[model samples]
Target: MPTHVVFIHGLWIHSAAWKPWQDLFEEKGYATSAPGWPGDRETVEETRANPDGLDNQGIAEICHHYADIIAGLDEKPIVVGHSFGGLIAQELLANDLVAAAVAIDPAPIKGVKVLPFAQLRSGFPVLGNPANKSRTVALTEKQFKYAFGNVLTDEESDALHAAWTIPGPGRPLFEDATANFVRNSPAAVNTHTAVRGPLLLTSGTEDHTVPESVTLAVVKLYADNTASVTDYHRYEGKGHSLTLDDGWKDVADDVLAWLAAQEL
Candidate 1:
């Protein structure tokens, strides 16, 4: 079987962040695609210049974008997502588009509780202001360190900061924290109930954004597979930025190993 892989990136990041993972998966004979969020720029410089480019788009639009891609595929792809992308993966699975999926330190999808200190703090910049709901909020160096750069060296963190970090639409975060997230979205409640394919949840031990508590909370929402088919793994000394941090390759290796075991 030819397994394709689709990577859905989280908020504040474009699809480019998945380049390393895409390269790895494609080399193994799996096809790959990392579709951009609506109005997203093609490059980091362009992203910085037009941070609001994707602001007009909503979760429903983005979800449908991935769904369209999946519907066109000859074979179902193994979907991988982190943070907001994780939520998207669950949405994709709910739509029965992928064969298997892994969500890494994914953002909460309504009803899934546990507001970690880190997640709260990381979101404070935007959540504090009502006006931010329709605007793009940029991360300060400190915010970046606490949220995404904690696991990397200062140099590596600086490099990452310089290369790709940009402002993001605060509306989605607000949305996730408020209304529809709780009552409407497909991933509104634990994904295990809807997920038929193999699912692996990876949490970073040091991550505050999607802390271990949050990951476990998500696992509990699953109504079936109590025999532990839904594998949950935690990596020590890692942060929410596990997929983009210096040791990202190791994290990717673990994901690949799990996917391989499923033989998808």
Candidate 2:
């Protein structure tokens, strides 16, 4: 059976965030879907106005939502995710619901701790506040520059911020950063090894949001005991915006090559 692909967007964005990638994947004969999380806004204006609307959504519910979509597909999917979306991909894998996974700049999986300056700065807005756990936070111009736009040109970064960026829920970041939790989310506990399928970890060399060090930590933690195949790649001259940057097609093509190798 041909592999199905489900592209999950991270916090602040909705299913439309993956439109560019969806178009590229569809052309290559992979059936694709991009589902929105609960209370995800349909428009940028709406998202900006109500960034906290979905802050209460927990990891388990989101994981179950994606799993339902995967269950509906006749064939298991090769999940592709970025940032928090990457975290969700691992949760799906934990359920043994996917054939393969491609995590691009994925957020940290449990027990993986190599926080880079960039990630720290990107998360500072919420990481500093105790109340942020139940609220939303907007990335300021300066914060966004250091966190998400460190590698992009001034003009390009400004355009990207204006066009696609939205305020994001703070709870996940709080959960991701918190050292102790009684009720663990699937991502907060390292159980993805249950997945026997192939796994690929891709990180942008210039990606400050999820630096190489952090990606390495996640890879080592998850790949340690899994008997399945795993691989890693670093794209030079690329930043956190690898999905929509000038060389996005290069990343997409690289994934296609990797997918061809799997013959899924």
Candidate 3:
């Protein structure tokens, strides 16, 4: 039977960003989909045109949005996500909805204590403005380079930025960063859930957005889960853009190999 693989994209990018991965996964005999976030349009151009469409969407709303889509699928899907999307994969696994989950450079969920300077700088565009909590945020090219493309060539980074970047709602970023303080609507994961299928957390050593230390803390949260499999792996010289960078195929292949082990 063909596996159902659902790809979820993080903020500041459109679902089309996952097209290459979708094609690769499909060629491997898996059914694939890259769903858009709430209020996201069909294309990146459309999303960039009206950034306001994504404003005010918090983690709760976005998580439920993907959950509803998953509820309509024919089978439990293998969820692969990047950045904020990674957090969504965890959320779905918590609900025991996915066959397996892979989170690459996932944003800090509740209880992740390692917030490095790079992570904070990458998030400054959204975090700088208190009012941004209810608005859309777009990164400048320099910021994008620093956050995602730092490991790539300047030319490659600039071209990638131009090709695939969009505005994103900042509410989720705020919700995630302050999950500990806020009791309501925190994007918290149930690390001890035994019903969850296999989960793999991948990190890039060069990733500034979600550093390796943060991923270590994320793994610790699930350390007590003996019933389900949870593993963490890292790639040297790769950044937050491992899923979208030039070496994305190599990383994807490694992911498929690991997922193959899950038999999920």
Assess candidate 3 and give its TM-score to the true structure. 0.98
Go through the candidates in order and give each one's C-alpha lDDT: 0.78, 0.76, 0.89
Residue pair clashes in candidate 1: none
Candidate numbers, best lDDT first, in rank order = 3, 1, 2
Give one digit per residue, the lDDT tens place, for model 1 in 1-264.
Answer: 567899988877667888999999888788888887766788877987987776745677778888888889898888999988888887777667778778898777766667878788888888999888887877777777778888777787767777767778877788777733355754463454464677788888888677778888777766464533577888999987788877899999899888878886
Evaluate model 1: give its lDDT: 0.78
Clashes of 1: 0
Ranking by TM-score: 3, 1, 2
Total backbone clashes of candidate 3, pairs 3 or more residues apart or in separate chains: 0
Each prediction's TM-score versus the true structure: 0.92, 0.91, 0.98
> Which 10 consecutive positions of candidate 1 have the poorest summed lDDT?
186-195
Candidate 3 global CA lDDT score: 0.89
Q: Against the true structure, whose TM-score is highest?
A: 3
Candidate 3 residues lying further than 4 Å off, grouped into runs, are none
